[model samples]
Target: MLEVEQKFLLADKTALLDQLAQLGATQETDQEQEDLYFTHPVRNFAETDEAFRIRRIGSENRVTYKGPKRNTVSKIRKEIELAFESGQSAFEQLTEMLELLGFHPLRSVRKRRTPFTCQHQQRAFEITIDEVEGLGLFAEIELLAEESELQEADNAIIELAAYLGMTHPIRTSYLGMLIEKETQSGSD
Candidate 1:
């Protein structure tokens, strides 16, 4: 599936939350996600602009692979995700297996996310407000679109962002921002 989304740094958290509420968007689920990123032993994911991540949310876990962004304005990418009902022990075993198969652990990103869903132009969009550990607050508006619905999705994202009074959307991923920060500070 394709994950098409636009991200923004939230200047006022409470005001945005209130705005979403006024827009009649209901909170669907709140989650704390710990994402463990990996790279192939012989390949650099950073250089390739791809990602392989194992995410643990509560007792549920999933592995996701995200292809490189297809465009510069929004995060339009191909994604494959699989979920398992196993607990932490099974997650650990899977991690070990991936390690044995030559995937090296790169970093872990932690965040608290609350997702709200609303309909616009007969299409549903999910807006996720994230409080990333060590990174502060951000908001993301996402619509799952097919290859043919790309333009429609883009328009809807822009309309929604404008409706919410969001300007200056960011194109950088949290991982990239963190990496740049580390580079500037000269520490891992």
Candidate 2:
């Protein structure tokens, strides 16, 4: 699947909160997301850029690999099912691989909110973090899934962003940030 997401840097949380309430977009769930970013060698040990996701949004261990489409994913689903049956989740396998690669683990966390979905889904807000706190942070608001949809998710979110006084878009993915920090810290 093609994952297209937009993120923004919120300058005012209080204003955003009020706008969200006015739009009836209540916070769905807030939790700390922790994870480890590591590098490994797969395939020919020369080509693949292997990485491990050691933790996730709370304890919800959902490993999602975004492949193009059906046929490829169908085979993956089978393999994943087998892994679960063997009592070895994908994360467990990944953890083992990372250990073998001589990569030390780096852990981090950030608070995130899972957005609530409703009919037409005219408004939605999802804030997530892989490492909790002021660092490795990001926020998102998705609106209007299809062009034909009557309600616009963006209008509400944009209004909230303005109300919150958003100034810039945070382009760095938390995973990427954590990797940089972990490697830098490791070198030090």
Candidate 3:
């Protein structure tokens, strides 16, 4: 599936929440997520614009692979994710297996996320308000769609974002922003 998403830095969480409520959006269970990103032994994922990460939410673990961005306006990419057994031991084993195969841990991104579901233009969009550790707050509007539905999905995301008064969309991933921040800090 393709992940058609637009992210924005949020200035006021309460205002956004009020807008969502007006749209009849329903809240989902909030979650604390830590994503451990990895580097391939032989390839540079950053240069290739790809990402491989293991995300841990409570006891559940999921491994996701995100392909390069397909568009310049939004974060349109191919994403494949698989869930593993839910436990510390299982998570460790999976990490060990990846390490054994030559994948090296890069960094971890932690965030508290609250998600809402709303229907717009006949599509269900997953909107997440994230409080990213060290990176401030962000809101993402995303829709998962088939390859053939890319344009429609992108349009829906854009329209919804505008409707919510989100003017500028940030295309940078949270991981990328964190890395850049760390680099700048180190240089300072």
Candidate 4:
């Protein structure tokens, strides 16, 4: 599936929440997520603009692969995710298996996320407000679509973002921002 998404750095959390409420969006349970990114043994994922990560939410574990962005506008990419067994033991086994195969853990991004969902123009969009550790707050509007529905999905995301008064959509991924920050800190 194609993941069409736009992210913004939130300047005012309350205002965004109020706008969401005005749109009749329903908020879902808050979740704490830890995504551990990995580096391939022979290839550079950063240069390739790809990502491989294992995300742990509570006892559930998911491995996700995000391909390069297909366009310059939004984060339109192909994503494939698979779920593993639910437990610490399963999580460890998966980690060990990856390590044995030469994948090295790069870093972990921790965030507290609250998700909201609403329908716009007969299409459903999932919006998330994330407070990333070390990085500030961000809001993302996302829609999963098939190849044929890319244009419609992109339009819906742009319209919803404008409705929320969110300008200057950030194209950088959370992992990329974290890495940039680390690079700057180390240089200083």
Against the true structure, what is each candidate's TM-score? 0.95, 0.54, 0.98, 0.98
1-188 per-residue lDDT for model 3 (tens digits): 88999999999999999999999999999999999999999999999999999999988999999999985577899999999999889888888999999999899999999999998778899999999999999999999999898888888888899999997999888999999999999999
Write one digit per residue (lDDT tens) for candidate 2, span 1-188: 12223466554465556655665665666665555554334332112323344455554554333222112111111111111222236556766766787755544444555454322233444432222354533456443334333224334545544554664544444555655777798999
Question: lDDT tens digits, residues 117-154, model 4?
Answer: 98878989999999999999999999999999999889
Local accuracy by lDDT, each model = 0.88, 0.44, 0.93, 0.93
RMSD of each: 1.5, 7.9, 0.8, 0.8
Greater lDDT among 2 and 3 belongs to 3
Candidate 3: residue 110 Cα off by (Å): 0.3
Against the true structure, candidate 1 has what lDDT?
A: 0.88
Q: Which pairs in model 3 have colliding backbones?
A: none
Instruction: State the TM-score for model 2.
Output: 0.54
Q: What is the lDDT of residue 179 in candidate 2?
A: 58
Residue-level error in angstroms, candidate 1, position 106: 0.5
